[model samples]
Target: MAFRPAQYAALLLGALTLSACARSPAENPQERSVIQNEDPFVAAMDEATNAAAAADRSARKTPSKPQQSDAPRVDTTAPKLSPAELRQRILRLTAGLQSAADTEAERVSRFLGVSFTPELMSIREGESIGDLEQVGSYRVSVSRIDRTAPGKHVRISFGPAGFSTGRPSICTFELAEFADALRSQGYDAGEVHLPHREQWGFVRYVSASDLTFYVSAELYRANDGTRSGKLCLADVTADAVKGRQ
Candidate 1:
């Protein structure tokens, strides 16, 4: 408290001189470490750490062999078929089915109660089929045993009548495609309009042949291009075709 400013400055210089005189030992090149502390355990840990780092940096990596998997990776993704492409395949399939049913009589015989693509179309005795025209996807299948008929073996023996099962199917065909498919087998389904079916699902493809197809396989661009198509294969007897409707 009684020290002068000049005396305080001299005391500070003396303390600094004493501190400078107390020198640290000259460091050994091998003992040099990043840690500058006096704690031997800490200094040893620092040396160990530096040694480990240097060893890690200089170590030759074995390039770890990619862990062998039981199964090799494969890209199983398949390209999706477009509507037009799908229509072509369906046409080919229809043609194949037609070829299977070789004779005209066979086509006429199996016309009412048979389907090529059974998943998209099939039937049994007394099983109801949906009529999209009359009841908005309402189905009324061929009665293999109809009590109303004389023999109870057929449904309709008259005008243009066929089957409809507009069940959502992966396989689909355009009106023209189906027409062309049928046409390939001598049946000529008349001009197919763009919007093949009416609002009530009534298709206007009328052909004068033993078997005619009125299938609504149009792709609705509004949705995911899913085709709820109606396949109507009519058997027009000579009497029915010759203005007998």
Candidate 2:
């Protein structure tokens, strides 16, 4: 199918409509013709999606001040060092990923389980990239903040049913497995609760230096009764995660 964000929004809206009884096909030929013609509902959704896309584009285009860092830059072109020191430097530099160099192209292809171009992706200050991805029956969205800074953050979320029921599919298990992978990478992992209204699925939070991660099931419900339980993860700098006083 075409990579139409409007269509995707429409399908999501369709799920909500599907939850309730749809109009009977035998209602009338006129009703069928109306359905075949332009749908006001779908058009509204398309407009909303387009507005959001434009806003995102504008945000990315508006330049932001460069990040200020207190830590010294890593010596990638360093003199020879002992094995232990070299490993330590590697860990520090990648405390949360030291760089994100993708810009120019509004869209780029990268592997995050499945190979797909990021149509709804944002790269800001040439330092961070954030995007939402739909992988088969799953939806994955992630953000890596402050790449060039010594202490950056990466957030990832994996959800089942990117295009179907709100209930989780096979991707539920993948959520936990991905958390395990983070643990294997030496992150401090734990489960955390979201606000009361958002407490609908599994949620895990991980922290490592400048990076903090959140893994949880999607907890979005459409007013029309469409529900979803997609897994999601987020890794971010501590400062970014912190609230302003």
Candidate 3:
């Protein structure tokens, strides 16, 4: 009933060939990429890579905020200065000396360090300049019509407070101290009375040669409610008292 040796050997050879043919393409290394595309592990990795690429593209397309400049901001608006402080700054900056040169342009420029243009056609009263020049927030004029034993009477006047863009008022009594300040600086300054308008006027420096300084202005109101005037700081050469001679 048993098979012969030759027959058994032939059966074994056939079985081996069938077993080799039965193996799937997935089991072969050359066909592994085809299988990997369908594998859950490979599919997850591809999905992660695509998601990362999409996020990168979206980030690139989104707009970013603009950067600000590092430069400092400048304030061109003028500031109001107290009368006393204004006087001090002017005197200190010029060292209480003003140039008396005939070159009016150079004189003003040296005093203020700012350029100015005067209306030469406006000069009046024999060397008294009625021309108004803008010095920041105030108007300025120079005069030397009166010459005295001390020298030429140089008068620099400043117009009122509306120059700095505010309604700043001043008490008339405060000017007395400023007059005293001039006297302290070796100026023959004195207060003069003007009853009709409540004017507290002062004449400073009989001989400054010629002084240049900014005069701050303040609005002063009278009791009548109808009268208002500007209180100002002026640098001048005093004229001789009338009737004294």
Most lDDT-accurate candidate: 3
- Candidate 3: TM-score? 0.34
- Determine the C-alpha RMSD for candidate 2 after optimal superposition of all C-alphas: 17.7
Arrange candidates, best TM-score first: 3, 2, 1
- Candidate 2 shows a clash count of 19
Error of 3 at 64 (Å): 57
Looking at model 2, report the run of 10 residues with the lowest lDDT sum.
Answer: 236-245
Candidate 1 lDDT over 75-132, as tens digits, reads 2222244334433433433343222132222242243322221122222333223222
Tens-place lDDT per residue, model 2, 1-245, is 11233332332344335335333443677765566466666446557878999999998999987789776543222133332232232233223331232111111112121222333345321222222232222222223343442322222232324323443333223335444554555444443333332321211122333322222222333223235444432221121221111
Candidate 1 residue 16 Cα shift, in angstroms, is: 99
- C-alpha root-mean-square deviation, candidate 1: 37.8
The lDDT per prediction is 0.31, 0.33, 0.37
lDDT of 2: 0.33
lDDT of 3 by residue, 213-238 (tens): 21222224313323444344443222
Clashing pairs in 3: none
Instruction: Give the better candidate number (1 or 3) by lDDT.
Output: 3
Off by over 4 Å in 1: 1-125, 128-140, 143-171, 191-245
TM-scores for the candidates: 0.22, 0.28, 0.34
